[model samples]
Target: MTDAPLGRSAAFKVLTTGYVGSTGPGVAATVSYLTDAGRHLIFDPGMVASPEAILAPLAALGLGPEDVTDVVLSHHHPDNTMNVGLFPRALVHDHKVEYRGDQWKNRDAEGYELTPSLRLIRTPGHSPEDITLLAGTPTGVVAFAGDLWWHSAGPADDPVAPDRDQLRASRERVLAAATLIVPGHGAPFTPDATTPR
Candidate 1:
């Protein structure tokens, strides 16, 4: 299938795609929809290498760029935030300490509250200011772990982690808080279940 299955629950909903082989360096757009109090919000707009590739899949699902009220980035890497500039009208949110190389765009460092049920958590370690979207989903609270662990890259790669200690600590924190995880490059999984060690 060109797109991954999108699901919803009482608290929030998500169309998790882009964790495919065709998108940006093997990354694609993963869009989360949080509906509360008559308001709609978006989380982790997806990795942006081929701009149209990212937007096309999301658009086919009836979620357009103009509909985005806020773009919550899991991290500052190009794969995650490259096409962020596409949303001209939305407020962009990121961790205060994020390291942006050459790509530039409008963003906020302070943690944001799109609504009480949805927010950004500073789950750094993968990057200086990497953040994960902590929101209520079908299975449970899901953390969109960005590069915290590379599921397919194998144990020897350690998923290209720069800091071993921080990675472990980040994993633990995410594990403690989120029952479901939408990892950066894999299908959503349960952390409590046995994961690749």
Candidate 2:
């Protein structure tokens, strides 16, 4: 994927890089820009996109791998987690249910959060451990929907979800919580963009 914009949140401008065929599927990746004055967060660095393809966007924003302070994966899928090693110095956040060791679950007892600005919505549909990242942007809330729903799917479905009910609830919550979403497999789009008029 190319470096598409995902709007800005506070001192950072978020961007994305499309799948580069580094793996079987081309899952879109997310990158963020932040100086020491801002929190540098990278969500879903992508699986198939080449290292250069993924990092170049950040480079364009004057951010190096080490500059990233946080790496949050929506799930354990290689598409979202494989490239994490690229940011060795970053603190990784994820639902522990998806990994074996040294992982973290919902920051709260309810498996979700809406504190301050960054909200981690525990959306267990595509995977039981998936969590969507919602950041308060200047435009509005931007959701980093990691496999919450494939971009190709219509408003009514998330075909890969193991639990249909959970996926439905998750979608509803995301639709309500975010104005824009950077999906795991497709381009960034607005919830209203996919809604039926």
Candidate 3:
């Protein structure tokens, strides 16, 4: 298979950077936007300081919530799914189904392609249902991996991961394929030797 799978590359940008503190209540979810094959997508549009944390950046790019075509949740955690209602017109995708309006279509996310440049792969670890969105941009492949690394530094060990072995395997899969990673919380960064395994 090709690196991008089958179509023109998409463009992506981070809307907001997320944070998780080791010893306080401070936390938020990173959000991102992507446009590809005529589709406007938002990944992990989760908890933020406010809705504007996501909306304002999207608005700056000339889009409103209604303009979003899809929203992909990496898992079921509220911190990674709370703002889904903001995009009323967008289809919502999770590991096992796609939902829009009241219609729910069952489909396995593994190898599923929403666009030539965008596809989904099952990467359960952080959560049993976690999946990753791999977007092929002009520069390289970018993986929107929720809670997998937590950030570039990685917690090294997820405090709540049910399957550490599975998590490690999933991380290997992503690291071998992606040039940059848009973690669940924090700015995107290129993977390197220092990246937690």
2 against 3, candidate with superior TM-score: 3
Instruction: Estimate TM-scores for all models.
Output: 0.71, 0.76, 0.97
Q: Which stretches of candidate 2 lie over 4 Å from their true place?
A: 1-14, 19-37, 97-115, 152-156, 193-197
Local accuracy of candidate 1 as per-residue lDDT tens digits, 1-38? 10111322325445554464533346565555555544
For residues 146-194, write the lDDT of model 3, one tens digit per residue. Answer: 9898898898999879999999989988888898999998989999998
lDDT of 2 by residue, 1-197 (tens): 21112334434455663432334443455544333225677777766446876687788888888888777788887767778788877767776432223664535312333234565667788888888877766677777777775553443565567788888777777777777777776666776655521
Off by over 4 Å in 3: 1-4
Superior candidate under lDDT, 1 versus 3: 3
Clashing residue pairs found in predicted model 3 = none
Task: Give each model's whole-structure lDDT.
Answer: 0.59, 0.63, 0.90
lDDT of 1 at 97: 35
In model 2, the worst 10-residue window by lDDT is: 1-10
What's the candidate order when arranged by decreasing lDDT? Answer: 3, 2, 1
